[model samples]
Target: MMGQLYSVGRNIEAKVMKFVSKALIVSLMGASLLAGAAHAATTDKKIALSNNYAGNSWRQAMLKSFESVGKKAVADKVVAKVDVFTTADRAVPTQAAQIQNLILQRYNAIVLNASSPSALNGAVRQACSAGIIVVSFDSIVTEPCAWRITVDYNAMGRQQVAELARLQPKGGNLLEIRGLAGTSTDAKIHGGITEGLKNYPQFKVVRSVTGDWDQTTAQKNISAVLPSLPPIVGVVSQGGDGYGAAQAFAAARKPRPTIMLGNRQDELAWWQQQKQDGYRTWSASISPGISSFAFWVAQQILDGKPVPKDITIPYLAFTQENFEAELKAIPKGGVASKDYTQAGAIAIITKK
Candidate 1:
């Protein structure tokens, strides 16, 4: 009887041991699955970007270029994602709000082309604190970001003014049309022009106003100044506004100003017009295309490549000597033809 009872006890103990071992195995497998999921989550990343405005041609070009090139580069990659936002008009606060929302969503990175530098300071600070890598382009933000990609605005400005001064060696009045209000690039370019003007004391900036970098706005502004215009020997305006200013001069039936300082595209067209009509108002200009360089900068950082704290791409100044050559060689618009929002996704998916 004692032996039988002992056998029964041993059988019960064996069953209990088997149950405990199976539970342990199940628990281990569950934990392993959870760990794998966490690992997968860590491998992929999110990027967010915002532009202050897309109202003008230049801004549109920028949007298109970034989307096109970035998409092509990352079509094969699987671990990356990009989110983009834009303020249709140059709305500073709206852009800031967009950045704040992106931070709340816990995006991994942000690219900012602020309409106004100082306006986005608070949002930029918040994003940096959240460990998001911030890349600034075109118009730089006031606060320090991870990287800034821009042209030499001041130099470009100075060069434009200097070119105009050369065109009017006798020291004529310079009618200056400015860019968007409160933008760093505007300040830099205008500042450079001021610096350049300092070199030529004879050149007087008789009238200056903000064209707001809009064609219609510039046309209106320039038209207002037309009554006092025949004295204006040269017109210095932002690229977009240059053609408008010229129109104002043309409408008055005055000899086109001796020299016009503006953007590359307008300068080329003006130079060609000058050749045909013997119009003297069109002179030299400096190229300040912001979109292509912006993409190049974003690509560098995304690829884990080192970039300068602030990268300044060289500008092309179109003068009579090389005007035709430069115009012919002007590279077709970079990535401006494609969809930009979808392009951001490609940036991350690229293997290298």
Candidate 2:
């Protein structure tokens, strides 16, 4: 009986030792797992950015916004490296080549500021085929690319016309300084303006000319229109051309028109100059903060968050009510920064 008791005691002790060992092993594993997670939280992620137009202030601001946000994303362990490519002016072909280079480098992801919608399709396809996640900002690629970050350019145009209608109840003559001919923003903005004017049969589009995003060309167009017998009441122009219009107005010695639809960066400066000049007729603007919008889209791409294939940011319309405070807050270039944080990379659809 004593021997049986000894055997039973040994079996119980063995069971206790096994349980203690298993528990200790589990506790150590849990501790190691927590440490690994902490390390991951601080890890950096790398990204590549390619821009089509660096000459324009909007494009410059867009690039700056991307770099700043990308740095923040890395510090937060969202991303590490950022490879940037910039092409002079609006050169689509050069931009496509840059995309190929980024793909060759095997970047984790790519962000593009496309010039023409259809021109960059091949490059975008190549990037996706190479397994690099793609994001387009400011302008949509003509072909179906991953995601597009933009503002409601259509609404901007519509709003410009609506404001003009309010100012000139009796319809007046209008002139347009169009941006690059093939861009969707140009098309949408013009289309919206067309539709908005249909409401008033008296409002007529006297001339529509291509500025090619050139200020000189815009000034020339405005100069030509200034000599026309019918006095001009309003002008709707693409970015980088507002100052040119102002110059034309000054040269012509005509009171600044009743309405001027200026770009985002030029708004505050333009408004201040108008005020200083004591020009009350100089008012109305639609500003789409493209740089800040681009950063927001990049963050959405990084975190596995789902978003529409195409997204449009809201455009702000400046009026007398808010122009003063708005101008005061606006930066020199009217560029704004966006913040990025770690989130799951959204599963973007890539078609080859």
Candidate 3:
């Protein structure tokens, strides 16, 4: 009777142990599934890059940087996919239609270089209403709901002219090589240039021409107008035309003025060459890799990170002392001193 009782107790104990073991295994499986789901949520985001124009090398470089960073994000499984679309006509309506299509396609986020600041407000609002993230950089949007990633163009323009004034205290005729007319950046920069130049009365803007932020266009325009203008002692340029301006000076067999360099690699190379010939100048620009910064911002937002609506990335300036190092870091035909990582982008956020 004692042996039977002991055997019954042992059988009951074994059954309890088996039951507990099964319960533990089921609990672990549930935990694993939860973890997997969390990871999938983190990685399964779709990002789209909406470019307003690809008219210049800077824009081209910006798009390339975006693509490179997007590929890296995909490889790291941080984002599932990246889609790129550009409006060839560079019209606000065209870009608005593109954004509408992106909304219809259900992109998780859009990284945009807007054609106009206020023109895309409605389209951006629509995207936001649909629970999509929108982050604009470079040529940005005026939508209050969407995030903006950019440098202070006003400051940039002011600084460029300031630098030119420093180089030429008794500033002579300054040919202002402007970017695309009517764009917010161009207007801001132009305003800054005008404001900053007020302190230097000797400096005169002998001519102003729209380069459209294209080296070839700038070259053609400068070439056409070079014969008509007085000898320019300095140039206030909104980038993309410094090299072309230099080329025009060279072609005209005229002495190169105290030209402010844009952060273009070719410009840096030219600067280095000119430096060898006892010429000295400095350069500053809003990096073309700003698109990549915008990309990272979009990623952070999609990952549920709280990013500020307005993030100002400061302009990068390279002087004679560090131009060589800066030039070496960039790829052939790329911007100088650009940072493209998530941390790099995050480091520049002025608010929140």
TM-score winner: 3
Cα distance off (Å), candidate 2, residue 56: 2.4
Candidate 3, residue 65: Cα displacement in angstroms equals: 1.3
Tens digits of per-residue lDDT for model 3 on 61-108? 788888989898787666889888998878999999999999999999
RMSD in order of candidates: 15.6, 12.2, 11.7
Prediction-by-prediction clash tally:
4, 12, 0
Highest lDDT among the candidates is held by which one?
A: 3
Q: After superposition, how far is residue 271 of candidate 1 from its true place, in Å?
A: 3.6
Model 3, residue pairs in steric clash: none
Please give me the total number of clashing residue pairs in predicted model 2. 12
Off by over 4 Å in 2: 1-44, 264-267, 276-292, 329-352
For candidate 1, lDDT tens digit of each residue in 253-335?
Answer: 76677545344455456666677765443332323334444544454454344456666655545556656665564444211
TM-score of each model, paired residue for residue = 0.70, 0.75, 0.81
The local distance difference test score of each candidate is: 0.62, 0.62, 0.81
Model 1 score (lDDT)? 0.62
Quote the positional error of residue 177 for candidate 1 in Å.
1.8
